[model samples]
Target: MTTSHETSLPTCELGPGGPIVSRLALGTMTFGVETDESVARRQLDEFVEAGGTFVDTADVYGDGASEEIIGRWAAARGGVDDLIVATKGRFAPPAGSHGASRRSIHRSVDRSLRRLGLDAIDVYFVHGWDDFTPIEETLDALTSLVRAGKIHHIAWSNVTGWQLQRIITTATLGDFVPPVAVQPQYNLIDRGIELEVLPCCLEAGLGIAPWSPLGGGWLTGKYDRGQRPTGNTRLGDDPERGVEAYDVRNTERTWRILDEVMSIADEHSRSPGHVAIAWLLSRPGVASVLLGARTAEQLNDNLAAADLVLSDAELGRLTSVSATHLPPYPYGMIEDFCDVDVWKRLGTASSA
Candidate 1:
C-alpha cells in the first residue's frame, strides 16, 4: 500500500507496481558514524517534514549502528507502519566470508526487521554482487522472502551492467520476481553507468535510485587543485586517504564539470551541491535520488534541491559536458547511425 502523506515533492512508484515513494530519498549511511543518534533523529525528522519517505540504509553501515539508530527513531515517531524503510544486506559482518545465501538472507531480514521494529521491510537490497553464490541462488532466496512476506521488494546495488542484465533475465526466464530497483554510484562526475547499466535498467523497467549524487562530495566544490582537504569533513581529517580518494576524480575534465556546475548554481543562487542534485533529479529513468547528508543542517540544505528545477539549457549543458564517450564498436557507432537524418526521424535510442 502507498504511504499516504500528500507532500509537495513529486512521487513515483517504487517499481512497476510497487508502493509509492518520494522522488527524493534520505540516506542514513552516516547515521551513527559521522552523525550521532540525536542528530540522526533530527535528520530523519527533517526529511519527513520535507516530504521524504523512502530511506536508504545498509546492514553494514556503521557496523549496523545506522539501522539501529533508524530503528529507535522509527519507533519513537509513531512506529514504522507508515514509513518505507529500505535497507541492504550481502556484506558479511566482520566474521563471515560473504553473504547472500538462502540462509544469510533469512537471517539478515530477520535481524533487520527486529532492529527496525517492524514486521516487514519496505525494500531489501543485496549490497553487492556475490560472486561466490550463484545469481539464481540469490534470486531464489530473495523470492522466498517475498513469498514469506519478510520483504516487500528486492533490490540490487553496485552490480555491473552485465550482472544486472543477467539477474533480470534469469529471474524473468526462471519465473522469479524481478528486481524492483538498482542502486549505483551516479553523479555528474560518474556517468559511467549511463553507457550500459542505465540502459539495461531502463529496458527492464527497474527503478534507478543513484547514491552519491554529489560525486563523493567532489561536486560540492570543497576540493581544491593540488591542495589537501583539512577539516572535520569526509576527506579533511585524513588528507592521505583524501588524496587517494581524490586521485580518481581530481582531473582536468572533472574541474571543467565542476566549473559548469558552479556557474549554473550562481545563475540560480543555489549551492553547488544543490545544482548537482537538481541536475541528477532531472535525468530519465530515475525514480528516486539518494541524498547522503552528514548532518541535519546539511540535510535541510540539500532538501531544497527537491524543489529546485533547472532550465532545459542548463540541464543540457551538464549533460553535454558530462556525456560519456563510449567505445566505438556498439554504442558510439549506433549513436552515430541514430544521428543520421533518416534514422533521426525514425527516433534514436536516447529519444526512446
Candidate 2:
C-alpha cells in the first residue's frame, strides 16, 4: 500500500539495519513530559503508519520518561527491527551528574538501554559538549561502546563547529568511528548554526537533525503578541523561562515575519507549523527535521511537511524576513560577496 512518493524519497543511513530513513524524524521530547503515555503511544503509532521510521529521544528528557515511553511503544508496535532508534546521553540528570566521562557515559548508556529495552541503540548522541572533559576521552569511550556492540553509531548534539572538527580530527588520528549525525537547535528563528555548524556538517558528510524546528512552538502562531500562553504545556510548566523564550515583546520583528508566513500558509491551506517545518526540509544538508509534537494531530500535520514544496518566491519571502543578521567582519564580508552565481549553478541559491 506504499505510495510512489513514500517509496522514492531518499533516506539517510544511521547504521546496520538500513540506509536513509524518511526525511522527517519524530522527536520524543514531549512524549513523556507534556503528553501522557496513551497519547504518546498513539502518536508513535501514527508516525510509523506514515512510514516514519526515525525516532529521536534523549535520556535527560523528562528524566528518562521519553525513552521509557518510546521503549514501551516499540515493544507494543511489533516492528522493532525496522525502526531506527536514536537516543542521546551526556546531559546531567536533575541531580547534577553530567559529563562525557567514561564512568558517566557507561552508566548513562546502560540506563538508557534499560529504559529503551533495546540491546544496542541505533544512533547514540553526546547530548552536549563537555568543556571540562577531553574530546579524545569522550570519543574513545564512544568508540569502545561501538566495539562492545552496545551502540551501532555515534552522533552529537548542541556542539560547536570547532568541537565537532576537533573530534573528527582526533577520531581520524585514533582510527575511531566518527559521528554520523549532529542534532542541533535549528529553525527559522535560530539560524545561529548557519554561521558555521551547517558548513562543517556538510563538509564532514554528517547528517544534521534540527531540533526545535518550531522555535519552541514560537512559529506555531499559537502565542499572541501581547498575551502570554496560559495553558500551553511548556509555558505553563516554566513560566519564567517560557516568558523569556516565547515573549512576543522581544520578538516583535519575528512575529511580524510570522504574520507573513501565516498568510502564505493560509493561502496554501496549510498550518503555519507545517510551513515552518517545510522550510527546514527545503534547506541544504538537512537530512531530517526533528518535530516534537504533543498530540497525534500535531504529528500528522508535521508529517505533511515532507509533501509540501514551497515555491521560489515563497522561500525568498521567508528568507528575507527571517534571515539572522550575523556580526560584521569576515562573516559579513562573505555574506555580502559570497558568489550568488556559484550557488545558482549548484541550485542552492534558493536555499541560501
Could you tell me the lDDT of residue 133 within candidate 1? 82
Output candidate 2 Cα RMSD.
3.8
Residue 99 in candidate 2, Cα distance off native in Å: 1.2
Best by lDDT: 1
Clashing pairs in 1: none
Clashing pairs in 2: 11-20, 12-20, 13-20
The top-ranked prediction according to TM-score is: 1
User: In model 2, which regions exceed 4 Å deviation?
Assistant: 1-10, 14-19, 93-98, 236-239, 242-244, 334-352
lDDT of 1 by residue, 1-352 (tens): 1344589667788777766788889999898888999999999988988888788898888988999999898878778665688999998533454587777877888888887777888888999988888988889988988998888899899989899999999999989878999988888888778767877877788888999899778888999987767777777765445323766667888989999999999998999999999988877678889988888888888888877989988987887777656566675577776653422221223432
lDDT of 2 by residue, 84-168 (tens): 8889988753244448977788889999999999999989999988977788888888999999999988889988889889887
Weakest lDDT window of 10 consecutive positions for candidate 1: 343-352
Indicate the residue-level lDDT of 165 in model 1.
93
For residue 28, model 1's alpha carbon misses the true position, in angstroms, by 0.6
Candidate 1 versus the native: TM-score?
Answer: 0.92
